[model samples]
Target: MKLLLDFFPIVLFFVAFKLWGIYVATGVAIAATVAQIAWLRYSTGKVEPMQWLSLGIIVVFGGATILAHDETFIKWKPTVLYWLMGGALAIGLLGFRKNLLKSVMGAQLELPETAWRAMTWSWVLFFAVMGVLNLWVAFHFDTATWVNFKLFGGLGLMAVFVIGQALYLGRYVKDGKEVPVEKP
Candidate 1:
């Protein structure tokens, strides 16, 4: 499924870290991301911009970690990517007066303009907080703790955030017939 495909790289990175170490994990992560992109391209006939950005960040930070024999670069990668996403969304909203979330999902979900802006800002704030939290864990804890946080804590928080978003947005559905899209 799409969720499994989306998480493949992170899962591989966790496994590799547990078996080997950060250096080996970094290599595995890079390879897995590359493979993910390739699979997406082959199946969808195109790669999303976010995927390209992730690949670029991993290669740059992971490559630096390998070449310099420093784990700091790899530790910074997640925070960098998170901040970039938040920044992009913020800029789209404030600079261009656009709600990117609405633009992307508007076809599927109809909602009022206020609800659209609220959702976009919610994601922006989430990304910002996540970025800061990643940095905090990366610096305050040891490698093992950081890796655990990255794999478990990060994913858990994301799942919760997404579920919360869906629930909140459901209240403002323009169709006036709210229904759960996924089976419980």
Candidate 2:
């Protein structure tokens, strides 16, 4: 349910790209993202910060793509978003001594403070790497390839990361209960 909602914009963008081209695809993406936010707000009465950020980026970058008649701006959107998220997480960890990931998922998954910190750092690193990866692909590959990478590569990497995180935290899942424990 939530996963489908999350992918709605990307899927629409992919389809639009196949049928039309980057400009039309960008426009479709913008619309899909806006619709996603609207639907989420209507259904849940609240929009997540990430969703809002994504919406803003798509609107600005996609709009620029359309208005400027250039695809570079749209291509940089994912990298920018990724870097921003990583930056925010880094600030929370280093500046405030807070694990943002734990703050978000703590209610569902309990782990030792050390584990939480490790997970937070892992995510920070992951986002940073993904940002770089996006830019690398964008610059090296053609627009069509970059678009495919955006939908498939980005999502694939994220799925792998989440799966790896789940496996890493499996040890802490205590008989179907979430119990935070420190490693001695």
Top model number, lDDT: 2
Q: lDDT of each prediction vs. the true structure?
A: 0.91, 0.92
TM-score of predicted structure 2: 0.95
Superposed model 1: Cα runs more than 4 Å off:
174-184
lDDT of 1 by residue, 29-111 (tens): 99999999999999989987988999999999999999998999999999999999989889999999988887788788777
> Each model's TM-score?
0.93, 0.95
- Runs in model 2 deviating more than 4 A are 179-184
Candidate 1, pairs of clashing residues: none
lDDT tens per residue, model 2, 1-184: 9999999999999999999999999999999999999999999999989999999999999999999999999999999999999999899989998888888988877688878888888988999999999999999999889999999999999999999999889877878876657657
